[model samples]
Each structure stands twice: as structure tokens, then as C-alpha cells.
Target: MTITRRDFLNGTALTIAAGLAPTSVLRAAEAQGPAYPPALTGLRGNHPGTFTLAHSLAREGAKYPGVLARESYDLVVVGGGIGGLAAAWFYQQRFGGNARILILDNHDDFGGHAKRNEFTVRGRTLVTYGGSAEMPPSANDNAAVRALLAGLDLAPRIQARPGDDYARRGLGRAVFFDAEHFGRDQWLAGDPFAALVDARNAGVRPAPEDLGAFLNAAPLPPADRQALQRLAQGETDYLSGMAGEARARYAQSTRYAVFLREKAGLGLPGLRFLRSRSQDAYALDADGITVAQAISIGLPAGAGMAAPAIDPRLGKSPASRLWFPDGNATLARALASKLVPGVAAAQGQEIVGARFDYSKLDREGNPVRIRLNSTAIAIEPDVRITRVTYGWQGNLQRVEAAHVVVAGYDMMVPFILPSLPVPAKAALRACVKAPLVYTKVALDNWRAFDALKTWRIHAPTMAYSDLWLESAPGGKDDPVVLHMLYVPTVPDSGMSARERFRAGRAFLLGTPFEVLERDIRAQLDRMLAAGGFKSARDIQGITVNRWAHGYSYMPSGLAPDDANLQVALEQAGRGVGNIRIAGADTAGSPSVTAAIEQSMRAVGSLNPKT
Candidate 1:
């Protein structure tokens, strides 16, 4: 018999009550009192609240095909993206031939937004479009992600460079920071602890510090100033070190940023600043908790942290985390490679993945087998799926004993279930997610102006949101620059700052060319005139892709912001069954961790781990 959500949790509770386990984690949880989840509440800042949480994190393009027939198997993975691929790959590795897996997707390829656009820009070849922009990471805390990299054997190939290195190459050493608000290097390089010590030693003093007096001074609201002052002094570690808001912020920030930037961005330089210094799911969503939760669960598992500014980077904040090469893209690619051979090699425009093999099974008594381009229509009795009538595609498909592991955008959840029972529908529907938008940009310039080595996130001069993306990551002589942006979308008429992004069309782009050709020409007039290529005319080809819901949101909420979402996933089989979920959106942690988590979650549906 299939285990329901209630059954699963109750079983867990019983298992704990039996005291057969060897760990005291539960007792510790109880003794520590009510703890904060640190995934969301840990990081409190203004953000775009557009993403919804009712489903998994993956996109089922608008042209999704309708289920044309009925067929059953060990698994029926609706989406063929990274999350699903990860689950399938891991299952294959751990269980081998023990489990049969079948992956179904509406798109022509398997990688989803990870598609690449290669073309000659100013006569240079580039991995132009779609997918990650950079490897936004800090240090050690990325165990699961690194483990995946180790499995790939591509860990050493990772290229690590500083943000400024990219900027200097592009700007001719003219890299600039805000003139006011914060000091030139204080925001990125200052150490608050060191400064404090120096200031206290009778006659000694630390020079070249502006954020100090300004941030700590009574210039703005008390709360803002308090955090700002701590940040200015580099005492942020105190928050997390002693089980305070800072630690919670650090965990939440690291988790959210690593997930979005490293795992999701995967070599992408998007998301100018993460909300907290956190590095896990708790950073994304605080769930419902109080000051006590903020202290206990939010902080690290050790002695209280030292004073701020003492090698702040080394103080255990989340932003200072390290990363692996290829980020999570390598993992996605590896997973995709396992599911579909041709799919792995063809992640770009030239048509990846194997050609459509089998047809959908349109009638009963048909042998279950693999089929391509088959859309899910609905699920009846919360178990049986019924394919919808579409433009006569062909015979129904069924893969005997095929198992599925889906990991993609959560919004596709509704469609994943071919049909749904009224009760399960309400529960799944209640797991609402915040709205989100993922946008990326790639540009090739005729002339090679410096500043490629240094990375920066300064907003455009005007009319748009402030520059929220990290600096570009290329050397001045790199010949091309790629930039990605994380723009949040607000709904209807709202007074929120995100209203600006909502005004524009949503695009999950990885284009090969920047539309601001005129701007490029102007910036490189001298270089273009000297380098042979004059204007946009000399530029070559370009490609781009867009997703309305590229990434999911990590709003502040109950324990582990995604707790409710996790609960919602239990009803995967109750929908129309047409929605196929995947992506970081559906992830409980919303990072590589969550991506990994949801994939396993999907697997438990088809084949229990134990």
C-alpha cells in the first residue's frame, strides 16, 4: 500500500518514540527548545515576492502536449530537467537495475533552461546562451554539491577568480565603488574586528575606515543601523557564533545564494547580494518562529563566535563560502548524460537528446514502453492517469517498470498530476510559493576594453532596478562578456519596489548578444575603430531563452520556509497529473541541497529508499 503524508510523518514520530535509533538529534531538538528554521527568517531583506510554492520548480513550456493515452509503469517522470535527472542518476547509481525509470518531458531537449547558445560573436566562439553564469560560492559548507562534483571527477577543473580581477581587465583598473553610503573598499574588504581592537589600544588606530562611523552612528533607523554597524565592524559572526540573528542570517544567505548562484546560476554572475550570510535552506525561509528560534537553530554548532571584523571572512559567515567547478551545472549535465546519451552531448541549440523513440500508448492492453513528446492529461482515482486527446500524435507509450525522479520548477506540480482528488488538491494548492523571475544576459563587444577580470554589480544609469548582479567574470582580453540578472516580479498593482521589474516582460534569457549594441559601440568607439570591427554590423549571431518562472522564492515563514511545500509534494499523484515539476523551485532548500533533496523525494514516491 502507498504511504500517505500523514502515514509518513506518523511513522517518523513512532520511530522516534520507540527509541531504537542511536542518535540524540531529536532529544537535542527538544532540549534546545523551539528553534528557528534559519532558511527564510534568518535572512530578512526586501525582495521580489512573485514565485508561488504550490508545485515543483521546473517549467513545462506553454506548448505542453496533452496526454493522449493511458500507460502505467514503476515511474512516470513528467519533466526531463536537472532535478529529475539527478534523482534518476542517483537511483541508477545506488540501486542500479533494481529500479526501472522513465522520464517524460514536453520540451524537445532534456536540460531545460540549461540549454546553451553557441555562436560567433565578433568572430569569436562562445557558450553563448541559457544556463549558469558563474560559480557564486564561499567555503567548505557545500558537502552534497561537492560530493556530486567528486562523483563527476571535474572538481579540479574549476576556475576560481576574484570579482575585482574581472573588473580590472574590463575597466583598465578603473573599478569604482560607491562614493558615499560606504567606503570604497570597506564594503568588500574591511575587517570590523581588527578595526575595533586597533581603536581600543590606547594610542593605536586603524585607518582608512568610513563605514565605521557612518554605519554605527545614529543616522538612520535603529534596526537598520544596528545591523549596519555590526556589518561595518565585521562583527557579523557574533550573530551566528552565539546563536543570534547574524548566524541565522549567515546560514540563510549562504544557503539561498549558493543555491541560486552556484547550483542554479552555475557559472553565472547573477544576484548582486544575497539576503543573509547563510548557506542552507533555512536562510531562504524563516517559517514561523520567534527570537528563541532565531538564536538556537539559527547559529552554528560550536562556541560563540569571536568579535566582528576579525577576518570576517573566516568568522563563519555564509557569504565567504567556497564553491566547485561547473557549480551544479556539472551535476545536471552528468545526470542528463545518464538519462539520455544524446541529450547530454546536445545541451545547446543543435538539438540534444536521442530522437523520439516510442509512441504514447493510446489504448489499454498495450505494452508499457518509452515514448517521446507525450503530454500528461490527467489522473483519475488519484492513481490512474488518463491521457488527453490531442493532435493525433500516435500509439500510447509505456515502459515496463520504468521509474521516474522529477526535479524542476515547482509551478509544474499541478500539471504533473494527470488528475487530482479534491482533498489532495486543496492541500497541494495551499503550499503557495512566492513569484520569481530568472533573467540572464550575454554580450560580445567588437573592441576589447579592459575590466573583464573584475566583477561588479552596479545598476544601469537609470530606468531600471539597481545593478543587482555580480560583476562580469572575464579578463579584458577575454574577447566577450556574459552578465546575468536575478529580477523579482511583483503581482497586480503593488507599492513594492519590485513593481519596476513587473512592468517589463519576463525572460529567462541566455542570449549571445546584448541589445545595447549602440551602447557597446559608444563605449568601444576607439577600440572598435582600432580593432577592425566598427559597429553592430560587424557583430555575428546570437541566441536567447526565457522562463516565466526560472527560479523559486525563499520567503520568510514557518520552520524551513519550504516545510509546507514539502508537505504539499505528498500529493503528487492527485492532480490532473499533467504538471511535471523540477528545478530549484520545488527544492525544500531551494539550493543544490534542495535540488538534491526533491529528487530523492520524487524517488521515494516510486520506490521507497529503505
Candidate 2:
């Protein structure tokens, strides 16, 4: 069965069209009523109409000439993502609760990458994370993040109950070897990585008996199968002589793919099988991550070598992470509610089901206002006040602020604030973001997964590298949301990490939604057909959260360790006069804690007392 664009658009025609249609048409569409963004389906994240002005100004140096209105605020924040919202929150704490703050974001929704996707099927409301899913345990340890969570009265809820209906039904993990990569369509009953990681973390080597049957059933060559069996059995020491810090350094510095081939004696097919193993976490392939970096993030390590100690600051396992049904988007909503009380009245877990009043977000006379569908194009600093120019509703509007906090992507800062020093701009340009897609597909039922006894499947070579069911208390007959991940990487292309990221961004932007939708349907059909799955019938709706610029680029062993580049990155976050930069990029990490901490630091820099 073939699904069409019309099938996905339950009632989101206006939202989907708003991005593609002309300004005149868009204006007419907005005249109907305020848009409730969470409920809108189809293509999301970096949706159309969001980045047109940004591209125009950055790429073509196009100027917006019209100045429709001029307003003033105590603080102005560019980019209304988590960082921007936190900046506003911190400004209130520092400068008092009455500080007038204006937050401008290009997307119709706030939260930046922390987006929420909602669907209604058979009178049941299903929620899924479109982007920025979890708050790691490390985030809770931060004083600022803890304070923010407390202020919002947000606490983690038990994600899975004692008797999860899906679990009780015996669903587990599996792997799908597609015909294109494995020479035949094959579905294995267990995930080798999951079993191996669990075994390694528990200080036990995985026995061949545990994975032998699964590997033998896989459509892999004999050499590749033997290599995997050896990896599981923990028979060979990849780093035979090295130990302690020396071994750690070597693992941290060497590429994982290289380690597999040269050190572990794995063949080309085995390397391809593991290419996308790291995509879900780092949005990079084996080539982009080092062996130590892979192990730190809980990827399966070679069994013979002692597992490296995991850095507490880095990502932990999913069991330790906490999130609401809509993921960190609930945190965004909570932040918004705290800023503008009219947005939402719910607290804690109730916020998960809260229906934010979009109309109340930007009401006049509010201490804090979040203005959506407004893209900041220029920041002209003056002696007393800085003027921020933005495009809103096909018109250029100007706002003046005593202090300006730029909380958008670091790479785009150079384009927005061209007056920065040469080195500072160069530093900002070096912060390249990885591109990824989080597609949330609403299915009428999860019978296919139930029948297959697998709720998650890792498809390394497919258009989407991973697919899993959301952790909700749903039986096989109930409607459920399936989350799919796609990280665009051009491996072995001889391009640097930054170059590869740019190419991936282009691919995400240039590809049409229809093409993406087709691939999603085809892949799901192929992987689930044996379990009596029919994509066109089972799929109720699809929302592709395409983030051309997704994760902040954190330096890894793949890149040359250059001190000058590190110095430049540090200088980039330093404020010039009244302008400050804050975001996950500023901290060189993609966690929510980084976003909040950087915002707090940016706000603290503006303290008059210091």
C-alpha cells in the first residue's frame, strides 16, 4: 500500500501550505485564527517559511528595507529556543521580575529544536517528541537547571509502569538487514549491540550462545559473522599492551571504524554494518566518532578490552534520563508558562497534557513576550541602545533593547551581527551543526511490532537508521506513536566534519517532503511486512521534524585537536559591549543543561555590579 501527502494531513493543510505558499497567501491563511503548533502534523522542525529570510540574509546578503514598527524592551533575545527562553528567565532573576523581554523566533512555534508533535486517533491523543527528547541525569545536577525545574514544579514521572502492557506482551529489540546492504531482506530476533552493551556494562562478556543464533540467521557474509562472534566472545585484545590512561587516550584518539578494521581485524562488510551505530546519539557515523567516544556513549565496546569508565558529565543510559510524553518540549512549555503566565497554567506532569494558549504568548503589556514567526535579520549596536531588525508577517520590524542576547545557532551569528571582530566571527563560523531528522509516525495499532516481539529495530543502512515505539502504556490494538531517526552522513567522502555537516544540511533542505514520506513508508513496509504490516493502512499520520542544522558540533577525536580553534570558540561566546551569545553551541555540547548554563552565564555577564 502506498501512502500519499493527503493521508498525513489530517487537518494541517494550512500549516503545511503556510510554508510553501506566497506571502500574500500566507497572510490570508494566518488571518483565520492563531495556529496551535503542537497539533499540526506533516513536515515540522525547520519547516518552510522559517529559514527563507535567514538564507536570504546569510547567503545572498539580501537586505530587508522596510521598518514597519519600532518597539523597546529591557532585553531582546534572538531565537526563541530553550536557550533564548532561559535567557529571558535569567534576565528576570537578575534585573527583577518586571523586565520587559521580547523573544523572536522564525518558526511558528517556540522551543527551537525542542518541538512537540501531537496526534488524535480514535479519540485518543498521542504525544511524541519531535526533537530534543530527554533531559539527562547530568542536567538535574546543575543548580541552575535544578532551580528552573523547581520553579516550573517539573519532576520526572515514571516512564514505564510496573506492568507495561506492551512489555507484558513480550516485545523486545530486533535488527533489520535491508536487501540493499545485506543482499537480502532479513529480520533478526535480537539486537547484538544492546545485548553486548548490557553484558559489557554488567562486567560480563557476552557468550557466543547468546548471539550465535541471531548472527547465524543474519544475512551477513561469513567473515563479518565471525568478526562479530569474536567481538561478542571477548577473545582478542584490540589494544594488547596498552592499559590505564594510555589505553584511554588511544581509544579516545582513534576512529572506531579504523579500530574495527586495523585493530580488531573486521572486514569491509562489518564496518558497513556498524556505520550508523552512533547516529542516534551523536548524529555521526563510526568514522566520525572515536572508539573511546563510542564507548563513553554506551555503544558496544570490544569485549576483550576493559570497558572505559563513563564520564558522568556525558550522556547516560536511557534508564537514567527523564522526559515527559512530548519530551523536552514540555520543559519548553513550562518555561514559557513561567515567563508568560497566560500561556499555560499547568505544573509538573500536568504540563505534559497542557494546552498552551498561543494567543496569550505575545499579548501586549506582558513582562515577557514570545513572538513567533519572527526572524531576526540584523543587530545594529549603538552607544546607548542596540536596534534589532526582524522580518514578521512579510514586513521588517525594528526593536530597541538595553541588552541583547543572541541565543540562536553560533554559525548564524556572523551573518546577523556582521560588526563583530574578525576572529570572533571566524570562531562563530567554526561552530557547525549536525543535521538530523526525527520523524514521528502515528500508527492505528502496533500489532506488527507485537507480532514480531520487537518494539525497536536498528536499520543501519536505511534512509532512517533507527525506529522505535514511544514508551506509552498501550496494547497491540491501541494507537501508538513510532519515532524514527535519520542522520545524514557522507562517510568516506574525504570531507571534513564541517563540510559533511554542510552537505547534510543541503540534502535535508533540498529534499521535498514527498520524497521523505515515500522513503519512510517503503522502509517500514519492508521491515514490518513479515509481521503482517501494511504501511498505508497502519499509518495514521506522519510528522517529519527535519532539522538541517540539528545538534551543536562538539569537538571529537575525528577533528584535529587545534588549540587556536578552541580559543576562537571561547572568544565567540564573549559578549561585545551590550550583545551576548548563548546557546548549546556556546558550551560546545548539545544537552539541555548546556543551553541553560550558557544562558545563565550570558545573563550574568551583563550584571552591572560585577
Each model's lDDT = 0.33, 0.78
Candidate 1 matches the true fold with a TM-score of 0.52
lDDT for 203 (candidate 1): 30
| Model 1 local distance difference test score | 0.33
Cα lDDT tens digits, model 2, 256-312, are 888887877778767777888778767778877888877765555564444645544
Per-model TM-score on C-alpha atoms: 0.52, 0.91
- TM-score leader: 2
> What C-alpha lDDT, on a 0 to 100 scale, does residue 58 get in candidate 1?
22
Off by over 4 Å in 2: 1-34, 66-69, 161-165, 202-205, 242-249, 300-306, 310-320, 561-567
Model 1 Cα lDDT, one tens digit per residue, 370-489: 222333333222233323221113222333233333454443444544345554444444333332222222345413323222233322111111212223334333344333233332
Off by over 4 Å in 1: 1-74, 91-101, 132-157, 162-164, 167-327, 342-375, 380-406, 415-427, 430-455, 460-478, 486-545, 558-583, 605-610
- When superposed on Cα atoms, how far off is each prediction in RMSD? 16.1, 5.3
